[model samples]
Target: MSFQQNLQSKLQGHLSQIDGRFANVKLLDQFETNTKLPRSYAVIGFVGFYLLLTFLNIGGIGQLLSNIAGFVIPGYLSLKALNTATKDDDEDLLIYWVVFAVLNIVEFWSKTILYWVPFYWLIKTGFLLYLSLPQFGGAKFIYYSFLKPVTDKHLFHESKPASKVN
Candidate 1:
């Protein structure tokens, strides 16, 4: 029932869960496989496309052009990640592509309609930014700060001492 005992109990439970999760697999084993050049190559791929787009002046192509480029950027990255066996890197890329593709399709088809407010573009931009930020690990930090303590306590209550048994 003491505070120290409660803390120890909680830590032990967490260690047990972590142990179970990684008992058969080493999460760090793949860390060494990521070489520098391949990583740089991925970056180069994005930069190349960006440079080409800048010179081609595709920005004037209107909504259809914007939609295609938006989807292509993430879509290309997603495929590249998969080809390289980068699961963690690909997760965000895949999600971004999906969102971009959907938005692109919707915008491309809805141009003729006039009911929607022009602020729809601003709203869409905000939603896209919100969705993409968490993939960079911001959400994990927020959740740990706000929910970890309460969750840790609920998932693991303090154990009674052997001497306390009747």
Candidate 2:
């Protein structure tokens, strides 16, 4: 067999495996069937969960919840976007997740400075809420207004087209 034939066979096998794995997953159906109620509940539940974590402040549990809120929530949302084949949604979630991850890294490096600020965790919790809640589009706005401009300038260097006078 030629190299091209072998490559085609491998590609077909990989695609079949992917199809088999996703055959049982019905994320899109679930999302379409009950959108509003689940989304609202998710937003409320996350808010309550964060509040509980903040108020309780138990030693290890607080840390665990913090990790879950910071990592797992966004990660799951991003994967859901991919699973549903929503390119725009996937991009938005990924951008938000990347920005949050970078901010967390910065916070780690500036722990001493942040520690002096009162209600730091509260502020962070609020920011996470803004990012995670799809009802607000806060993350999308922030990305386009702030991150996109900077990234566009540095990465693509594409100048904006001039506006024509009517």
Candidate 3:
């Protein structure tokens, strides 16, 4: 086979593998069927907690929660993704959360300007709601459209070895 044809065949195979891996990731369906608690209850609880953080202005509790939401939980989910054989919806969610967390951290560092913005907390809270609520499929969309392309390119590169000099 020509080099071009062989490379094209390999690329197609990799694309097929990625498609097969993500074919069964129905985020909304998984959220509906897999959880023991109702989705509304979870949403209410999260909103309530956020309200408390904002209204009461507790010491470091808000920061702690932000850390958990942005980093700890997402890191756990990413680890879970690595361990699972199927790489299900959680994997997609993790990608979204991790990217969001990184961006949030960058924003956090610029709190002086961000704090002056009107309804900043409200906007951030809404974004968090969209991310955590599987019904929105925000995470799934991000995973498939943005993260997957970049990640797949790196993955393909990593799988191939460098040529050795004679």
The local distance difference test score of each candidate is 0.51, 0.67, 0.62
Off by over 4 Å in 3: 1-50, 71-84, 142-166
Q: What stretches of model 1 exceed 4 Å from their correct place?
A: 1-60, 101-115, 119-166
In the range 1-166, model 3's lDDT, one tens digit per residue, is: 9999999999767656654554465653355368864344444566587767754446645545554555555566667677778857666666676668655776869988556865455455556556655567666676677767887788655432453432
Q: Candidate 1 lDDT, tens digit per residue, 1-166?
A: 9999999999767656654554454332343245423233344465566445533445443333334445554556556777885577666665455555555676678875324554343344344444445345432443455445666788566557844775
Q: Write the per-residue lDDT of candidate 2 for residues 49-150, one digit (tens) a residue.
A: 777876466663554565566677777877788778558887778777867876688788998854596656655766776786667777788778887898
Pairs that clash in candidate 3? none
RMSD vs true structure, all candidates: 20.3, 18.1, 16.9
Q: For model 2, what is the alpha-carbon lDDT of residue 149?
A: 91
* 1 against 3, candidate with superior TM-score: 3
Model 2 ranges off by over 4 Å: 1-50, 60-63, 155-166
Evaluate model 1: give its TM-score: 0.31
For residue 131, what is the lDDT in candidate 3?
65
Better of 2 and 3 by TM-score: 2
Which candidate, 1 or 2, would have the higher TM-score against the true structure?
A: 2
TM-scores vs. true structure, each candidate: 0.31, 0.56, 0.44
Model 3 / residue 111 / CA error / Å: 2.7
Clashing pairs in 1: none
> Which residue pairs collide in model 2, if any?
none
